[model samples]
Target: MCTAYSSDCPPASSALHGGPAAPPAAVAAPVVSLREVSVVRRGRCILAVESFEAQSGEFVVVVGPNGAGKSTLLGVMNGFVRPAFFRPAFFRPGSGGPGNGRAEVLGCDMRSFGGWRVRKRVALVAQMVDVDARLPISVLETVMVGGYGRLGLWRRPGKALRELALSHLERTGIAHLAHRPFGQCSGGERQRAAIARALTQEPDILLLDEPTSALDWHAQRGILALVADIHAERRHTARPLTTVMVTHDLNALYHGGEGEARRTVPDRVVCMAEGRVTWSGPVADALDAERLTALYGTPIDIIRHGPRPVVLF
Candidate 1:
């Protein structure tokens, strides 16, 4: 957590004003910050966040029931969905002036900098997308498209780019399927390919929208493990990647099945409901049965499994 001064503290007087100079406080800026952000569609509000922030290199998992606005929050982070206050008048049709709020991603003001300008630095692996079975695009080719955002329209991908794409495919454990048609791969393989494609972008921020949804239990476990491995691997790099994943699977916060040992977890978890953040804190604190029950509007029981609590609905 970032340290912040209390509102009761007095403002520091400057030396130029004939007062002793106060030492500058050291505070790291958040990679993602939003205040009073809201998304309205067809005269209805879908997401409304009073304030949110994610420090650099932090892994945040968003969990909520269907229609709780979990995916909409991710969309706001990735700049795909502009806030009601930030949308242009033309985009809103009959709406008057822009709404009120602030959205900053990687130091760029989302209101003016625009999503396309920062998209190259932000890679998003959205939910599973069905592909035509006869499409001729190879898995390797599909992954290489991630780099096109940075390449722009004039430059063509060369040998180096192709090699980089292959390296990511290998890292994702899909090297053998590199030459296969993307549409032919299974759900798990396609998710892996999607991740490889996102990695090829060399993103600073990674946004995943239900990468494990619609898959079998085995496939879901594989995808979760893959995500954990990717997060761990990227943490050692000079520029550690910031990851935000949205999932409805509560068990994902732990490593194994119900009775298995829980060894890994994200830095934080944010619970959303009715277009608002109901809770945000460390994994341990956010997993309380009562808290979750209230958020999901359903009975939620937590069973103690050794040192970790497993969710039992």
Candidate 2:
């Protein structure tokens, strides 16, 4: 079921549709690059990255113990940290994207691109909604914040823009709550709203840090399923969006494809420990009992009974 696409993103050429299984190219350009990166705060080391790359349309799971610096890593990728030795480039480590800032994306360096342009191509959904829930803003208006990167100012969204936001809401199954106040909703509702906000940004790189940590089991699965769906659709788009998720939901080898249904199997798994990589390989292999037990300091078992991944801690 692995399909390919062309430069213009026209559903891969007709010839490539039914052709023999050609190997997937190396995908030279990385949407995110962290080179020799190290972050320290309050005399504590957070991120000590040797190297890492997030390819186009790839789903990357960052897992580790509570203090593994997962959040700090996401912040650096989104340009919140200024790493002295960090050699980062959207396409390379020093390229250009939309504006004059150099941040190469979709296979180009972002160094020639600007922050405004870079924000257009990447959207970050924080782990928690720390803002006042008591704000009077309706859900629709809240979702509209995603468009701010593109709108660039106080300009309100037009009818078409509103429709697009609603469409995103419907796709996420939160359309009915559009009129509700932000803080009055349940945690799950707010989670979906955050996702809808990211969708409204319509970005290529979706960086999420611990998105499902606060939700119930069903809501966690729903959020992961939503992310899987979005990534699947990116397969046909020009930039071919990539999702970088920082999560503790270790249902290894379980991927739900774009609200379509859970995947019979996942593409791969990546595990981190002690601010360094412990093991990274295929999802099935990475999540084997031996490896996971070591990472979490507990006995672990992955059950294969359901369509979604289930792990017993």
Candidate 3:
């Protein structure tokens, strides 16, 4: 089911090829694990997941209708929100065997799971970064903020950290706007800067919340390309970065601009509805039109726009 967006999609690796079968390598301990996780706000249950796990270096995409808890899931990963009763574990880079270390959120146990150090290793880029462009900071300085977790309380960014931030800005294709006030750039530029900030941390896991939301068509395409580039560029590293992105735009799951030359789908997909994980598996099987229509409560048609599956009402 190839489409015009194939270029931007993930390669046809085994992870994208088969149904929901586990990969043959005897799955390593997941970088982040959740069990019986549930979130309640003001006595109203907003999110819940019985069991979830993301392997190191795998790309997972979360999608669902509005208010489906997609963003809440990302918040849970980095300890921004507290859950009712769930064991969330992180498998640190050099940690022992799978499930060897367990630390509560905001408190360091073994391997510093919760604390300032953990924040440095797990980067979360939320859509809120785009809402307030009047932050009164230059793009370069904004990116440097990502390093604050690593810098701790006393250290300034210094020369080396600034250079690293510039490199990431360049990688995300916004180096030219380094000195520009972040409020002055376009939506795309701000989103790129946000990504650059996240990359500055050199995080082990990157959690993105609807990076392409509220942008024009061109900007949306550009942001998705930037994400694919980040994933591809880090594929060969010893410890590749793992990413979990939440998006409501289903088209991003597949389509890309003409002649873009790179297309990649997520290795897995998690679909939510009314605060619970209704489906969790490979993107190929999880993105059925009928299934999504049920998930979104609208008539969704997965049509072929000259070879691609276009999921829309």
lDDT of each: 0.80, 0.68, 0.74
Off by over 4 Å in 3: 1-27, 86-117, 129-135, 256-263
- Tens-place lDDT digits, model 2, residues 1-313: 1112223442222234444796443434456665556676777666666666776667777888888777777766665554434333422555633322222334433333232345666688897855577798998988888887787577667886788889999988999999999887877788888889888987878888888877887888777787777777776566677778888877623755543236532344567766665566766566677778889999998776655546788
TM-score for each model: 0.84, 0.78, 0.80
Model 2 bad stretches (over 4 Å) = 1-27, 86-117, 130-133, 252-255, 258-261, 264-266, 303-310
User: How would you encode candidate 3's per-residue C-alpha lDDT over 1-313 as one tens digit per residue?
Assistant: 1112111233334254355785554334556666566788998889767666776678888999889998888877776775555433321254434332232322222123233345657898888543455667899998999887888688877998999999999998999999998888988888999999999988878999989888899888888877876875676566667789999888787743233423345778899888888898876677698899899999988876664567778
Candidate 1 lDDT over 171-205, as tens digits, reads 88999999999999999999999999999998888
User: Lowest summed-lDDT stretch of 10 residues in model 1?
Assistant: 5-14
Indicate the worst ten consecutive residues by lDDT in candidate 3.
Answer: 1-10
Highest lDDT model number: 1
Check candidate 3 and list the clashing pairs: 7-262, 7-263, 8-262, 8-263, 8-264, 9-263, 9-264, 10-263, 10-264, 10-265
Error of 1 at 262 (Å): 5.4
